[model samples]
Target: MSWFGFGFNAFGQISGRDRDGNDGDTSIVYTPTEIKCHVDEKSEKSSELRASWSRRASLHLNGGRSLCLAGSNSPSGICDTGCTDAVVGESFVILVFPDRFESWDLDSDEKIPIWSMDVKTLCDGAGSPFNLPLIPGGYIAMTPPFYRPLSPHLKATRLALGAKHSVLLSASGAVYTWGLGSHGQLGHGSLSSEGQPKVVEALWGMRMIFVATGGWHTACISDGGDLYVWGWNESGQLGLPSRAVRKAPKYQTSEETVVTDLPTCGAQPEGEKDTQVFISIQSFPALVDITPSSELKTVGCGSRHTAAVTRAGDLYTWGWGQYGQLGYETSRSDEPYLVEFFRERQLRVVDVTCGAWNTFVSVVKKEVATS
Candidate 1:
C-alpha cells in the first residue's frame, strides 16, 4: 500500500526516503508526498492495515498482530529497527518514544528489548533501566511500568493519542481520556489534568464508538452516528458558535429558527435552572448540529483542525486552514464546511489520517459503467 505525508520533514519522517544517512536533512515538507515503503510487491493491502503518528509513525498491522515503526530514534526499540523489523503477535503491548522502545507479551511482563543507555538509561529521574511490567491491578507511573490492566468490566476496542493527550474507546461503547488538560481537552467539564484514564461523565448514557484527538481538542462519534466535540477552539476548530457571536444580539435566521426545534444534546441546558451560558472553552462534549442531517462514518483530527466523512460519502473539514489543510482557500473556520473536491470527481473518502500540522485522506474512486 502507498503512504502520504506532509508537515515537519526535518527528520525525513514525512518523505519516507533516506535522509543522506542517519543525521537527516533539515527541510520541511508543506504538501502531501507519497511515502515509499519497503513492502514486497507480493503483499496485498488489507483494510486491517493502518498507521498512526506521534513525533514518529507506527504502523499497526492486522489489529496489532504485527507492527512497524518509522522516523528518528525512539524510546521503543521499534524505531531502532527503522521499519525494517516487524513485531508480530497479539500478546505484546508496545510503547514507543523518540529514543526508546518497550514491549511486553502477556505471558512475560518483564521482557525488555535490548537497547543502549540513551533511551533506557533513566526512568523517573532515578537512573532505573526502562522496565515495564504488564500486570493487572497495579499502580502505574508515567515512565516505566506504563501499561496497566483495565477493570474487568471494561474492554478497550481502540486507543488514540494526541500530542499530550490520549483517547480510549471501549467495546461497550464508552469513552475515556487522560493526560494534559491545560486547554480543557479532557472533556470532563473542567480543565484539570488527569494521570489515569477517566470516563467523560458529561456524555453519560451516550454510546460512543470512535474517538480522535487533535493537539488540544477531542472528537468522538456516537453509535447513532452523531458527532460530539470539545476542547480548544482558538481558530474555530471545534465547529461551535464563537463565544463573541453567541453573546451578540441574537438574530434568529429562518434556518436557525427551524434547527432550534431539533432534539439534540446541546439544544437545552441541563441542571436546576435553564440559564443560557456562553462557553469559550468547551470543557464538556457538545453535539455539533451539522446541516442536511447525515450520519457520520469516521472522524480525524490535526493539531488545530478536524475532519470527518459522512455516510453519504461527503467530506467535511474545519479549524486552522492557513496551510490549506482544511481543503479550503480560507485561513480558518469554526464550522464544518463540506469540501467538494473529491465529490466532484465521484470519489468516496474511505479513511483519513492527520499529522502534527497536516491532513491526509484516502479516497476510493467509484467505478463507471459503459452501456
Candidate 2:
C-alpha cells in the first residue's frame, strides 16, 4: 500500500521531512508527493487517515493492535499497544480500546490523560459503545462527561462533520443535515439553519451508500454511482460554475458572502447559449455528472476541493487547487479533472481521505499481483 499527499504542508504534516529533514524548506506541496507511512509491521487489517485542523494521523487497525503515524506534538497515549481506534480533533485525541477509552489533550508534555471511560460503563450507559442513557427514541453521543442525546433516532449508519455543520446518513439511505446553513451546506433547499436534524428533501428517494462533509459543503454517492453535491460553491468544490472563480468576481472580502439568486434551478436564464450561471451557495443537492459512463466507488472532500475514485481504478479531482490539492498539477477547476499521473504510472486508487487543506490517496499497482 502506497500513500500520496499534496497541498498545504507548512508544518510537515504531509511530508514528515524535507530533503534535509527540515520543515522550513517546503510550505506547500504543489503536486502529488509520496509520503512514508511508518509502521512496525505490515500486518495491518485496515487503515484510515484521520485529519484535524493542523495535523493528521495514519491509523492502522492491526487486529486490534492499533498504531498511529503522526507528526510533531501528537498525543503520546494515542499509540497505546492495545488501541482499536482513535478520533483525532483539533485540540484532543481519543484512543479506544477493547476495555476502555482515553482522551488526551494535544501539546501536553506531561502525557497525562484528560478523560477516560471503562468499556462496561460505556456499553451499559450509551448502548454498545456507551449505553447508559437508554433514550427510547434517540441515540447518545459520548461527549466526554455528558451524553449528547441526538433527537429522532433515525437509525443512523454514518456521520460526517463539517466546519460548522453535520451530516448524518440513515440506514434507509436518507441524508440529514443540521448546523450552520448560512452558506447552504445543509442541502435543505433554503439557507435556513435547522435547530434539529432535518432530512434533505431534495434526495428523498435516492438510496445513498455514502455521505461526506467538510469545509462548507456536503457530498453523497447514490447507489447507482451518481454524485450529488450541495453547500458552498465558492471554490467550485461542488464541481459547478462559481462566480468566485471568475476574472471579475463579485461579492465581498469576508466570509459572510451568501450566494443565491442564480438560474441554476433546473432551468437556464432566458439568454444566450454560452451564458454561465455562476453559483456561490447551493442550498439544494445537485447531481454532478463526472464521466457519464464510469461509476464512482467513493469520494472525499477537502476544505476547498473534492476527490473521488472510480470503479475503473481512476482518480478525479476538482474545485480549489491553489496548493495542488487537486492532484492534476493545476491550481483550480470548475469541472472534474482526471488525474492522469496515476494512469501513466499504472496505479489504481483504492481509497482517499482529504484533510482541511490537503488530500491523501492510497493506491496499488493496477495490474493484479501474480507472485
Candidate 3:
C-alpha cells in the first residue's frame, strides 16, 4: 500500500542495505525513496505490490493466492527456481534475472524449500529449532511452466513487457503478441517473430484496454481513450512526429507500364512528388495523438521514456529526458509534455511510473473550499 523508489540502486536495490547499510554510494537515488518492506517470521504476510525492479520486488495476496520476493541474488539459476535469495509461497511465477530473484512453481514438482536452516527446521515442527540465520536469500519451488499457449477460453486481462516482447490483453478486448519481434514489436505488420500468442491483426475490431512497453516500443490504450504506438521510434518514443519504414509499392500489374525500385530524384521537379520516405522503424500500431480532447488514464514505459496519466489529473512526458526523466529541463522529447511539477503546486498527478532512466509520480493534494 505504500512503496516508492527511484532509479538504479547498484544492488541494495533501493537501500535494502546489505553492503553495510549503504554508506558508500551504491549509486543513484535521485529522489522518491521509501521502499522497504520485509517481515517474514517465516512467511505469510504479503498484501500486494505486484511487480518492480531496481533490484527486485514483488508481493501478492489471496487474489494470486500469496507470493513474495525481495531483491538481488540470482546466482544464474535463471530467476525463479530456488529463487536464489528471497522467496514466498503459493503459485509462483516471478521472473527477471539480471542479478537476482527467480521462481516457478505454479503447482509443484517437489524441489522447493531453500530458505535454509534445514528449511527452518522443516517449518518449525520443533525439536528446539530456531537458529535461523541464512537471510542472504534464496528459495526454490518448482513446477509452473507447462506452456498452455492461450485459447483454453482466452482470459488474460492485461500484461505487458517489452525488452524482449510480450503483450496480452484479453477479457474480450483481445490483443496478443509474443516474444521478440525484432522491431515490429509484434504488432504484426511484420518484423516477424512470434512463438505462440498471436491476435493483433492490425487491431481487428479495436478494443484494447491497456498495454505498454518501451525498449522496443508498443503501446495501447483504447476503449475509446485511444493512443496506440508501435515498435521503436528511435527517440520520438512514438509521439510520432516521424520515424518510419514505409516502402510499400510492390507490383500491382498495370497497363500504364510501371517498373520499380522506386528511388528516382533525377529529373522530375514539375508537379508530382509523393514518394514517401523515411525508414527508422515502426512496424504496426500507430495512433498517438494526445489532446484531441485528452482522456487517457494511464500508461507507462521507460527504457526510452513515455508516460501518461490524465483523467483530469494531468502528467505527460515523452521519450528520453536525459536525467530529468521528462519532468523538464529538456534533454529529449517528442511532444506530450505537461509536467508542470504537480501543476505548479495544486497537485493532482494521480499515477505514472517508469524506470529505465527514471520517472515516478503519484500525487494528490488539492482540496480547498472553505467558508
> Highest TM-score, which number?
2
Could you tell which candidate, 2 or 3, scores higher by TM-score? 2
Worst 10 residues of 1 by lDDT: 256-265
What lDDT would each prediction earn against the true structure?
A: 0.59, 0.73, 0.56
**Candidate 1, 39-155: lDDT as tens digits:** 333433322222333233434232222233344333243322221112222233344433444554434434465222124323343221322211223222233345445565556
Write down the TM-score of every candidate: 0.63, 0.83, 0.28
For model 2 the TM-score comes to 0.83
Clash number for each model: 11, 11, 11
Model 3 Cα lDDT, one tens digit per residue, 183-302: 777878777788878988888888888887767887888888788877766566666543322233564234322212112113333433443333246677878777888988878887
lDDT of 2 by residue, 201-304 (tens): 88999899888887999999999999999988888899988766664334444533333444234655444333445787788999999997988888989898
Residue-pair clashes, model 2: 11
